[model samples]
Every structure is written in structure tokens, then in C-alpha cells.
Target: MDQQMFCFQCEQTAGCAGCTGKKGVCGKSEKTARLQDELTGALIGLARATNGGTLYTDDTWKIFIEGLFTTVTNVNFHDDTIRELMGRVHEDKEKLAPMCSGCGAPCGKTGDYDLSRLWHADEDIRSLKSLILFGIRGMAAYAYHAMVLGYTDEELNRFFCKALFAVGEDWSMEELLPIVMEVGKYNLACMELLDQANTETFGAPVPTEVPLTVEKGPFIVISGHDLLDLKLLLEQTEGKGINVYTHGEMLPAHGYPELKKYPHLKGNFGTAWQNQKKEFAGIPAPVLFTTNCLMPPAGSYADRVFTTEVVSYPEIVHIGSDKDFTPVIEKALALGGYTEDQPFAGINGGRTVTTGFGHDAVLGLADRIVEAVKAGDIRHFFLVGGCDGARPGRNYYTEFVKQTPEDAVVLTLACGKYRFNDLDLGTIGGLPRLMDIGQCNDAFSAIKIATALADAFGCGVNELPLSMVLSWYEQKAVCILLTLLYLGITDIRLGPTLPAFISPNVLSYLVEHYHIAPVSTPEEDLKALLHEGE
Candidate 1:
């Protein structure tokens, strides 16, 4: 059968093989997916042109990051946006390799790569390149968020181009393995830049209990990764009888003292990212998306979906370069919400979920945690979090959390926690059983916490009594998984299905070297984790 188009970059491909037909599971059309591949191929050519040269500049890095971020699942859903970005990539490539323009003698070099070659390459090579490509796509989300906060790092930017360049080159495992680890290393730097930008700009997040109740009145719901957008929305709606609620990843913003101070900044709205379509249906107020994990808007509530930052949905109101957010404010007032305060609750029936227990909060209690571990009061630490999705097997995360030993501590981050975060697991020692570690980008916090524990125990991170059971649905999780692998953090249990892009050989390599395993039944996996801890 002839392939319709290529899209195997996410957890839900068209047929578990790849998105070869007209549209992907995420609703990405074949035409748009092909353009994404072209944009990526152009980036690779630009990276190749910079080989062994110092010609790389900040502009080069920005284009590379933007290009990668655009390819992530649910970020850029418009064909026009992908086409526009491809034009920009081509323009940048021309500037980098002017010699390739009219040379009759083929250099075999600077021209844009035909992505079909990658689609048809050896499975192993294609898998490694896919890793490099997808890993950067995830890292680019963090980089884009950090950049929005006026923070930038040179090494992180440069490594992006280097990684993209390697994706185009003919490289084997011996050569690509180091580059793979480098992706993790640089992703750490990218994540740190974002963390510093967020903390420095908003202050260290403290534990915050976000309510689920929506007070009757004019209110705006802000989703995505852009704090600045949320800030602007709060400012625009201030004293205007309009309330603001955080949704999805934006729920963590409630932890920041600066944001939480807004009297009208009410509570969180929904559960995981996957539920946005159904949850947002008939939502009275406007919903602003600041970043990724944006599902295709359901027609029932498409009018209420407003996009800011890089999140674009066709026909939706877009708060552009000015960041005014006036349209969103107007939408809130027009909707006028419910007549009275409407009480809502999380999936677990809890009225609220506590978030913003970042690294600073957790590490402050390090002494108590270490003591609990030493006394065998806390038998295991499970980092049970990642991107959540609608997949059937995704119940593994909720089940995993449920089956965790009462003596163990659960550290979670990202939108994935919406599955079971509302359950009151109580506390082990002085630490809460379920600790929320900021946003998805704050996986840096989990990494920091893990490293700190390893340091205190005088052993490597893998040697510590921590196990990472991750669930991935998008590219950002790919970068984070790469970062974990880069840190030599082993024995990670990843699911609901290994990325379709990963070939059998590459999967075996990860299994053999990193002891990475797929998730089985929660009960079975819990037993294996406990055995490993012993």
C-alpha cells in the first residue's frame, strides 16, 4: 500500500505504524506533515553548512528552535503556519550556504534534504535521527518558553544546531550515541534556563492549593506554557469584574506568589491535556493557549479557544506580538459565566489539588526525606509522571500511583498528574505522598531533586532508591527522557506504547544499555520496581 504521508513522531500515529494516510490521529493532514518534514530537512541543511565553523549566531538558533517546536504534536495545527515556517527555514539556509545557489558542480552539501530519504533510510539510522529530531522538538518548547521570559543560553542554542546537523549526517551508533547523550546534556541546560527565567521572574513557587470551583462572573481560562500571557490576561482583567482560571499546564502558575496574588485568579478548570476537547465544550469564558498539548478544538467550544504565544488554531483569536490580550478580556465579559459561584472538583472528587511544590520546597525537607529512607519508613521513591493522553493503557499511571507502597513517596510533575493527583495519599514522614513539582518544564526540578538525593546518599542517581516510571504522548517528554538517559539515570519504565518512530534495534539498544522497559500491569510493574529497590 502506498503511504499517504509521514508522521510517526508522536505516541498516537495513524495506524501504529505511522501516519501514512490522509490525516494523523491528532488530525494533522498529510500535506501539513510533509511540510513539517521539509522545514526539519532545511534545518538539517543549515546545521550541515555550519560544520566546523563559528558561523552560528543567535538568529540561527532561534530558527532551529522554532522549527523544531512547530513540529511538536498539537502545537502548530495550521498548514499555513508550517508553510510560513518552511519559508523562513529556507531563507535562513540560503544565508548560511549562498554557494549552493547556482553551482553546477554538485557539492552534495548545502541544499535542503529530501525527507523521503529519511523516511526510507535504514530503520536504525532513521530511529536515531528521529530521536535527535523529536528530542529537540521537545527541548525547543522549553527553549521557547524560556526565551519568552528574556532568558537565553549560548551553549544550549549552539547545541541545537549541532544536533540538527547530526540528524542529516551519515552517523552510526558509535558516533550518534554521544550526540544522543549530548541532546540530554543540552536539554538540561535548556530546562535550567527556563527554570531560572520562571523562578527569577515569578519568584520561587511555594505549595499552593488551586480550587476547582468557578466563581460565577466574567472569567478567562489560560492554558499553555506562557506565564507572560497569563500575567497580561490578569492585568487586563483586573478590576474589570473578570476572573481568571488556570487550565492544564497553567495550573502551576497558581503557585507563584506574583500570580496567585490576583484576587480574581480563581482555580484550575480541567484535568489532563487530553480532556481539553470535551472539558472545554460550552465553556462560557475564553480559553487562551500559551503553548503545546493543544488538541484540535471541538466545534462546540472552538469560539472560546484563543491562542497566544506560539499556539495557533485556525479561526481562533490570536493575541499577537503586542500581547495586549484585550480580545480575551472582552470574551470573558461577553460570556458573563454562571449566575452564581459554580463549585467544581477534580477527577478524584477533591475540591482542589496542591501544586508548586518545586525543588526548593522538596529539597528544603531533604533531611526528613533522607532520614525516612534510612529508617526504612520510606521504602521507595516513584517519579510517576509525564504527559497524559487519552490512550486506554494510560491508566497505568493512575494505577501505578494507586498501587505504590504506603511507605513510598510519589514525586510528580507535568499535566500527567491530573490522572490521580487529587487522591489524598497522605504523607510519609514529613513529606506528602504526592508532591507536585511545578509544570512539565519543571521536570528540571525532579532532576534536581534526584541529583540532590543521590549526593546526600553518596551514590549515583541510578544507585539511589528512586525509580522513574514515565508516560509520554508528545515531543517534550522525548527531550526529558533523553535528558534522563543523558544523566545515566537508568531503569526507567516508559509507556503507554514506545514511540512508533523507534525501530526495533534502537529499542533493543535502550533496553540493553539503559534497562529501559515498557510498562506492564501496574501490579506487575510495582512488584518489579520493589524487587529492584531491594
Candidate 2:
């Protein structure tokens, strides 16, 4: 078969390898993929120009972060938008290195890289660089979210340029490996920055129950991980006789005080992002996507789809920088929502799901958790979370959570919790058996909770009786895994399938050093995890 382009950044890449056909499994066209590559090259060029004695301004950092984030899987599918973004990058580069454009014989120092070179590079080199590239791409999402909330970290901003610079260089694995690990180190900072931004701006999240029912009235559905967008929309829709319902990662927004204060914020609309096509079909309310996990719109709901921020699809109405959601609000009013209340349920047929078990919430109960463990009231702890996707073996997560013993506690985050979040897992030692730790960026919260627990128990994190059974679908998951590896945590179980970008040698290195293994089954993995020290 003739390969049009190559992309293997996600878990469901074709045949567990690269996507090399006319359209990727995510429904992006070959032309879109090329534009994304060009955008990436332009970003590298911009980074180079800025590195050559050009001062980094707030605008410079914004363009750099948005360029990398725009290429993330399932974000933007419009070729023109990507080209426009590339144009902005080129413009930024020209301003940073004005003399380079007029030079008689130009050096490649400030020139855009040909990404095809990296794509066709040696396998191990490609794998290592992919770690760096995809890791930063994931981290950029966190940075963008934080930036939007009026928070900025200078080191996090500088590391973005450093990582981009490393990607375009002709460095060896020994050289690139440190930068790859540095990505994890810096991503930890980015997640912490975002956590502070979210918690401070919206107040700390309180464990809140979000219903699955969409009330009978005009309403709008907001997806993605942007709380600022949700807050803005909530403010605009307040007292307008329109309701706002969160979908996907926005489910956790309900737990935030400022957001939940809006009576019209309503409840969650659907499950995970992958179910949008079927779940959104013929829906009356317009859907606004503020970030990734956006699928190509089905014809039934294409007219109702509106994108904001870096998330764009061809021919969709995009809410611009003004953040005026009038179009979305009008569409909601026009659609008139459901004639009667729509009773939706999570995958397990439960009518409500809970979220907002951030680090503060969990650590508040830390002493109780520790006492429960010491008294043999809690048997084990499992961190089962990551991005959700439309793959076959994802049932493993659902089954794994289902098969967990009553004495064990499950802590989840991101869109993956939809797998079994609605199940009545009951309670253990006064805490719900299932605890949602907010969005994927809230992996920092999980890390904090673990660190605090380890402190209370007087042991290393790996020595605690906690197992991580994570499912990966996108680059965000990649960076979180990298952060866990950076923290020296071990014995992680990663599946559906290992990343297509990881080479055999790299996989062996991880296996030998970190003890990371692909998941087998619920029963087998459970037995091994439960009896490891015994």
C-alpha cells in the first residue's frame, strides 16, 4: 500500500503502528496531517529564531504553545486554520530574525526544519525524539490552559523552547534522552501551575455529584479541559434561560466552587469524547469544544458543532477571541433542547457520577486513609485513569474496576473514568471506593496524594501498596506516564497497546529499568499486584 503520510502518536494508530493512509483513524485527512507537520516545522523554526538572541515575549510564548497544541491529535482538522497558524509562526520568526530574510545567502539557523527528515530518521532516534516531541506537545496543552487563566511560569515557558530546539537538532540518543526526561521534569511544573490556576481561580474543588439528566430547556454542551471557557460560558448564559452542561473532561468543572455556583451550569451531558458522534446526533443544543478529544463531526450534528480555542474543524462556527458565545446561546435557544427531561446514564447505567477528588480533598482524608490501611480496613489502592478511546480492549478498564475488591479504593481522573464511574462501588473507611482526581492535568494531584501518603506511612511511593493500571490514548497520557517514570515510580501497567512510536530497544530499556508492562487481564494482573510483596 502506498503511504500518504505517517503518524503514530496515539495508542490506536493503525495496526498498533503508524497511520499511513489517506485518513488517520481519528478521521484527519492526509492534507491535514501535512499541514500539522508544516506547523510543527514552523514552530521549530520560530524556536530557533527566538533562541538566536531574540527576546521571548508573552506573545511569543503564546504562539509557540498554540502551534504545538494545534497539532495534537483530534484538536484542529482544518487545513486553512493550520496554515494560518503556520503563517503566524512564520511572521513571528520574521520579526525575531528580520535580517535573515534579506540576507543574500541565508543560513539554515533560523530556517524552518523539514519534518520529513525527523519522520524518516533511524528507529531508535525517532522513538527518543518522539518521546521529547509528544511529551512537549502534551505539556503544551497544560501550559496553554494555565496561560489562559492568567498564570505563567517562566521556567515552563523556557523549557518549551528548549524542548523544541532539541527536536530539530542532530543529537544522539544519549543527548536526546536527557531532554526527554527533562520534558517530564518540566511537565510536572506545568501541571502544578495549571492546578494552582484552576484551584485559585475557581476555588478548591469539592467532591460534587453531577447528574446525567439534561433538563427540559434550552442548553449548551461544553467539552474539553478548559475551565476558563466553561466559566465564561456559564457567566454569559446565567439568567438567560439557557442551561450549560459539561461533557468529557469538563465533568470535573462541576466540582469547582465558582462554576458550581451557577445554578444553570446543570449536569454532565454525555460520557467520554469518543462517544460524541453517536451521543451528539440530533441533539438540540449546540456543542462547544475548547480542546482536544474532538472527533470529526457526523452530519447530523455538524451544524450544531462550535469550536473555540485551538480546537477547530472545517466549516464549523468558531467563537473567536472576543469569547462571545452568542452564537452558541442563540443556537441553544433555537433548538429548544428536549421536550421532556432526558434521562442519560453513565456506561454502567447509573444516573450520576462524582468528581473533584483533587489532592486537597484526598489529603484531607489522608490520616483516615492511613489509619484504615494500618487497621486492615483498606486492602489496596489503584490509580486507574487516562484518556478514553473507541478501542476494543478498553473493556479491560471497565472489568478491572468491576473486579476490584471491596476493600480496595479506586482513584481515577481524565476521561477514562466514564468506563465504570457510575457503578455503585460503595464506600471503604468513609471514602467512596471510587475517587475522581479531576482532569488529566490533575495527575499532579494524584502525585501529591501519593507523596503525602508515603510520608505518613514512612516509605517510598513504590513501597506503598498502590498499583497504577493506566489506559493511554493520546499524547497527554504520554507526558503523564513520563512524569511517573521521572518520579522513579515503577511497576505501572499500561495497555490497550503500547505506543506505536516506541522502538523495541526503547521498550526493553523501559522494561529493564522501570518494570513497566503491558496489561494482561483483570484477574491475572490483580493477583500479581495484590500479592507482589507477600
Candidate 3:
């Protein structure tokens, strides 16, 4: 078969291999795929120009972040916009090295790389490099969100370039493997930076009940994982009589104190990003995507879709860096939403889902939680969360959560929580059975909670009665997975499928080192986890 391109960075890749046709599984066209490759190559060139230096300005970091995030699954579908961004990438590279041709220091160093070499290279090297590349792409999103809130880590900024440059080098598995793991270490730092940025800005999420009903009047559903945009929108739409709703990963924004203080910041609108087309069809409101996991919109409500930041689609209203959000507001007012309350239930037919169980809320009750664990009220803890996609195997998560013993608690984050967030497992002691940690970036909270519990028990994290059953789809999940591995957390069960990028040697290394395994049937996995902990 003559393939125009290859992309396997997502869970829904065609035939469990790369996307090798006119369009990718996520609907990314071949031209966009090539453009994304070019953008990545240019970024590598920019990183190469830095020569592992750490003195670059915020503008360079901003460009680097947007370019990397633009290639994440479903984030950018418009080939023209990607091509334009490629020009920006080239411009930045030029700024780093203006006279490569006529420089007295003729080092032949800084030039655009062709990424096809990495794809066509040896499988083991390709696997490690792919992990590093995808891992940094995920970390860049978290760093970008924090940077917007005036929090920038110099180490993170430099590591991004260092890792990008590493991908372009002729490194062996021994050399690249450490860089791959360091991507995890730095990703942990990036997630922490973002956690501080969000909690300080939004005032730490409190347990808040988010209704699933769309109230009367016009509303705009804020999707993706940007709390700053939500805050600004809530400010602008305060007295306009239009309401705001959260969807996908944005659902957790309702739990933040500062954001929830707005009476007009209404409930959530839809389930996970994979269900956007079905849930959003003919809805009488506008939707704004602020980051990744944006499926190409259907013609029915495509007119109402607005994209900001690095996320964009063809013909969609693109909100610029000014972050005005007026276009989305205007579209919402024009739509003139439902005149009465429209009750929308989750896939389980539950009418409401609760969030705001962030680290602060959970750790605040740490004493009680510790007592409950000692008292056998909470037998085990399961973290079943990560990116959600349209894969059939993803049903394992829902089933696993459903089949978890009542003595167990489920802590979920990212968009994957929507799978079983609505299911009421009742409470253990006074705490709810299911705790919704904020965004995937908020995995910091999960780590904190786990570490505190371990400290209280005088044991390591892996020795605790906690299991991490993760579902990965995109690069963000890659970083989170690496973070778990980097922390030396063992026996993590990952599904719906293992990443196609992991070579047999790498997979064997992970299994032998971390004891990682693919998820089996929910009942069997649950029983094994429960008994093994006992």
C-alpha cells in the first residue's frame, strides 16, 4: 500500500498501527499530518539552535509550546493554520541563528530536521525517541497553561529544547533511555508548576456539585483544560444574562472557588471529548475548545464551534492571543439557548456529577482517611483515569470502576472520569467513594495524596494499597504515564491498549523494571488487585 503519511501518537490509530491513509483516525488530513511533521522538525531545529542553552526569552518558549501542542491528537486539523505556524517556527529558528550561511563560526549546526528519519530509523531508537517527543508535547501543554498565569519554570523551558534536540541526535537506547525517563521527571515538575498556578489563581477546588442540565437562556460550553479562560469568560458574561457551562476536561473548573463564585457559571453540557459530536448535536449553544482532544466538528453545530490557543479547525472562529472571548459570547447570545431547563444525564443516566475533590479537599480530611484505611472502612484505592477516546476497549475502565469493591475508592482525573463519574458508589466514612481530582495536570494532587498516605503509613507508594489503572490516548497521558514510572510506582495497569510506539525491548524493560501490565478483564483485574493488596 502506498501511504501518504504515518501517525500513531493516539489510541485510535487505524488498525493498531500508524494512520496511513488520506486521513488519520481522528480525522486529521494527510496534508495536516505532513505539516505537523514539518512543524515538529522546525521546533527541533529551533531547539538545536539553542545548543542546549537556557537563556532564551518567554517568547521563544511560547512559540515552542504552541508548536508542540499544535501536533497533539485532535488539537489542530487545519493544514493551512499548521503551515502558517510552521512559518512562525522557521522565523524563531532564524532569530536563534540569523546567519548560518555566512557566520564566522561555521558550525553547520542549526538547521530544520526532517522527522521522517526518526520514523524510518531503528525500532528501539524510534521507540525511545517517540516516547521523549510525545512526553514533552504533553508537558508543554501543562507548562503553557501555567505560563499564561505568570508562572514559568526556567528548567522546564530549557528541558523542552534539550529533549527536542535529543530527538534529532544520533543517540543509542542507553543514551536516549535516560532522556526518556527525565522527560517523566520534568513532566512531574511541569504538572506541579501548573497545579500551583491553577490553585493560586482559582482558589483551590472545593467539592461542588455540577449539574448536568442546561439551564434556560443562552450558554457557552467551555471545553478543554483552561481555567484562566473560564475565569475571564465568567467575568465578561457576568451580567450579560448568558450562562457558561463546562464540558470535557473543563468540567472540573466548576469546583474552583473563584470560578464557582460566579452565579452565572452554570453546569456542564456534555460527556468526554469523544462524545462531543453526539452530545453537542443541535444543542442551542456555542462551544469553545481551548486545547487538545478536539474532534472535528460535524456540520450541524460546526458553525458554533470556536477555538482558542493552539487549537483550531477550518472555518471555526479563531480567538487570538488577546484572549478576548467576545466572538464566543456573541455566538452564544445569538443562539438564544433553551427557554427551560433541559435535563441531560450521563451515559449511566445519572443527572448530576460531582467534582472539586482536589488535593486540598482530600488532604484536608487526611486524618479521617488514614483512620478509615486503618479501620478497614477503605480497603483499597484505585485511580482509574486518563484521556478518553472512542476505542471499544475503553469500556474496560467503566466496567472496572463499576466492579470495584465498595470498600475501595476511585480517584479519577482528566476526561476519563466521565466514564463512571456519575455512578454513585456511596461513601466510605464521610468521604465520597469517587473523588474527582482536577485536570490531568492535577495528577500532582493524586501524587501528593498518595505520598502523604505512604508517609503516614511509613511505606513507599508502591507498598500502599493503591493501584493506578490508567487509560492513555494522547501525549498528555504519555507524560503522566512517564511520571508514574519515574516515581518508581509499580504494578500500574494500563489500557485500552499499549502504545504502538513501545518496542518489544522497551516493553520488556518496563515490565521487568516496573512490573507494568496491560489491563485484563475488569473482574479478574479487580479481584487480583484486591487480593494482592491483602
* Candidate 3 local Cα displacement, residue 291, angstroms: 1.1
> Best lDDT goes to which candidate?
2
- Rank by TM-score, highest first: 2, 3, 1
426, model 3: CA deviation in Å? 0.5
Output the better candidate (2/3) by lDDT: 2
Candidate lDDT values, in order: 0.85, 0.90, 0.88
**Whole-model lDDT, model 3:** 0.88
Evaluate model 2: give its TM-score.
0.98
Clashing residue pairs in candidate 1, if any? none
Kindly list the per-residue Cα lDDT of model 1 for residues 474-510, writing each as its tens digit: 8889999999998888999999988988889888988
Residue range with the least summed lDDT across 10 consecutive positions in model 2: 50-59
* Runs off by more than 4 Å, candidate 2: 52-54, 102-107, 532-534
C-alpha displacement of 65 in model 3, angstroms? 1.4
* Candidate 1 vs candidate 2, TM-score winner: 2
Tens digits of per-residue lDDT, candidate 2, 53-110, equal 2466557889988988998999999998899988888887787778877665545655
What's the distance in Å from true for residue 242, model 2?
1.1
In angstroms, give how far residue 285 of model 1 lies from its true place: 0.7
Q: What TM-score do all the candidates reach, one by one? A: 0.96, 0.98, 0.97
* Clashes per candidate, residues 3 or more apart or on different chains: 0, 0, 0
What is the Å distance of residue 205 in model 1 from its true position? Answer: 1.0
